[model samples]
Target: MTGAPIVHTASGPVRGSWRDAGTPNASAAYLGIPFAAAPVGELRFAAPVPPEPWTEVRDATSYGATALRRDPGGTLIPEPPIPGDAILNVNVFTPAVDDGAKLPVLVWIHGGGYTEGSPASPWYDGSRFNRDSVVTVSLSYRLGFDGFGYIDGAPHNRGVLDWIAGLEWVQRNIAAFGGDPGRVTIGGQSAGGGAVLTLLSMPAAQHLFHGALALSAALADIPADVAKERGERLAGILEIEPTLAGFRSVSESRILKNQPKAVGGRKGLGLLSGLIDDGLPWGPIVDGELVLRPAADALRDGIGADKPLVLGATDDEFTMVADRAPRALRVVPSTALLRGVLRDRGVRRAYLRANRPQRAKGSAAMVGRFVTDHVFRSLVVRVAEARREADAETWVYALTWVSPTKGWACHCLDVPFWFDGLDRERVSDLAGPNPPQSLADDMHGAAVSFVTGGAPGWPAWRTEPGTARVFGGHPQITTTAYDNTLALL
Candidate 1:
């Protein structure tokens, strides 16, 4: 209990150090343990393969290399990019080591629009969850073109395969870390949230996890034809054949540099319009194999109907982006801006009528709210509605807490709160000084409750469709949480 704790995993024995040693909240942290081999060389675009076994005790004291080769500057979460090729790893935090405690597990996936994100963020540290008697794990997987891009002769959704490999590792070895693989809950924010929902709807992934939490989920659901087109476009730009051998001929840096160009659309202001119109250019694709259909459609058909789920988005997820062009937006009428995004005249008028409060805030705020509602809030409603007839146990929430620094509820404002990590570094930059610990208690407590039990201290969405736990606001629950978004649908 005092020295570095060692757990004999199925792959090998990993020695982990103690955090807050000699304290009641002390936990064992095993960092950078590989569940799969390095995804370089032959394995780059292939499904994940199991890591080689080791006899020597491997040091699990530091973070491993990230799939993101470089730092993605200006990310809300502090996801520092670590260097090296072995990017398929997991970091586990547990209150007990081989103690037969059988605590519930939370496997978190970081969000970076499916292109960038690191499992090495201090914000994702699992010390808080350990204190609450839940084993926490954050994992790394292939990103960008290497993960999701379609290439001839390559297995589709390699990133998703990596997720399944990681979960399979958990099922095989989590018991050694005092975790119950049977009670595992997978959750994430943004693209990570999308990853959770994608896994939930996947028939291949249903057995790997028992519950799900999706915060501001963004689905790619790229049609097979579209993904193929994008892949061909990328190969054409790189001046290589659109085959596995052609991609392997180019360096990772070359691929990363040119992937954006392949996600072709418009430039400047038209880019925003493109994002709203086209959705994420890269993410899980409906390849008719691994991902049979769009996640919403699958959910509607009763896929993952037996599992409990909690999903929601912040009120103004990306409204802060609008603040950048306040002067120009102020000059243009909100209705004029809506015409560009929502071309249908009747739909535009109905949307404006439903969002009068945002309209009162001026064009910039209105446009920002439109982006948020379009990308995040509407998805929440659609998914909830999809699951209603399926009889899935679902809970919904709205993080209405406005960040004092950002001036809107915004994207990612609820992450640290859900992890109960307000004290983590750089949180003050987003949540500001004097963020309410009481709010963290409420949000994080709900997450813990959901992971430990099936319910999240709120009414299921199916009980009263569209109802949600409204955080950071005066009211506790509301059935009209996504009324404004319903107008757009």
Candidate 2:
């Protein structure tokens, strides 16, 4: 049980090194293990296929290549970019190796809207989950156009198909790493969380995992025309047709070079501010087969109805937009935008009439609040209610812990606390040098309990006056999640 640990997967044997080598009970890490063949050349836009078998024990100690994407703006947190074709990989962390432990597993999908992000990011280490006797897995799915755009010859939601492929890999190989495939929980934040909800609505992904957690779930979807328009725009930029063959003709670098143009020329907004502004420019689409319908419709229609679920959001999920932008440039919901949103969601005209404002003019904070409630929080609530209506076990939560420096519980502010990653210098920078360890203990403990036992250490969500476990200065269950925001939806 010394040197690097070796275990046999369905494909072949893999060699993994200790993640925190020399540290007490150092976890064994198997990184960059390919779950599918390189999606390149003729295979570029097809569904994932099993990786070519390896006769040799492949090294699984470092991250694999991240999918091709635009570089999000600078950040204290490190998101390393390794480029290559065989990027569909997963990193596994286990408390012990070759011991047949069958520990609970938590498979995490990183968030960067649908356009950018990598599990290779340093903030996604799984050692803490291993410390809690949970086998943690971090995954890298296709992002941006390669992952989600609507092309003529490719299946829509290819990124989600990547997830299904990864889960199928877990079913076949996780046992060798002391994990129980039957006791798996899939979770994510922001766009990743949205993916979780999309998976919940997808029949193809229903049985792959036992439990689910969606943090700051942005339950948003784009119309087919919108997805097609972005794809055509990208093809136009590449001087080709909007098809698989068209994209294949160009280099990934060239495709990325012109991707920003598809979303209004990037405008220097961090991590997907462009997509976020253009209403999720690229993501899950209504392909009529894979997606079937919009996310909300699919969920309310009883997709993944029997599975237990956890839905959560930050108190000010979009409030940081205010802090980042000037008052004049902040996102104040115009009457048209608000009315269109309500109309699209099918909100009752009576409710919209009573709550709709003549015009909103305010500071960045006010604008942020409006966007947070309209875009993120209300959607979280709607999904929770949908799950409840189906008599499913569902739990809701909100992170109200404001950062001392940032002063708002903005998007992605909850990642560190959930993974028990507060000690990482990168996380320390986001949550403050001295963030609350007790909160991390409670939140992470709840996540572990849910993944292992099918309950998130709380009662199921009830109808009317919905409740959510508030995680912040004073953690408690309260019926104040939406605060009558449903009426304004």
Candidate number achieving the greatest TM-score relative to the actual structure = 1
By lDDT, the best candidate is 1
What is the C-alpha RMSD, rounded to one decimal, of candidate 2?
3.6
Candidate 1 per-residue lDDT, tens place, 1-489, comes to 767899999989999999988889999899999999998889889899999999999999999999988886777899998999999999999995565789999999999989999999999999998999999999998998899999999999999998999999999999899999899999999999999999999999999999999999988899989999999999999999999999999999999999989987344344456669898888999999999999999999999999999999999988777777747666799999889779999999999999999899888889889988888999999999899979889999998889999999988899999999998989999999889999999999999999999789989898888889999996799898889998887
lDDT by candidate, in order shown: 0.91, 0.78
- Where does model 2 exceed 4 Å of error? 20-24, 68-71, 75-77, 97-99, 266-278, 327-362, 463-465
Question: Would you list the clashing residue pairs of candidate 2?
Answer: none
What TM-score does prediction 2 earn? 0.90
TM-score of each: 0.98, 0.90
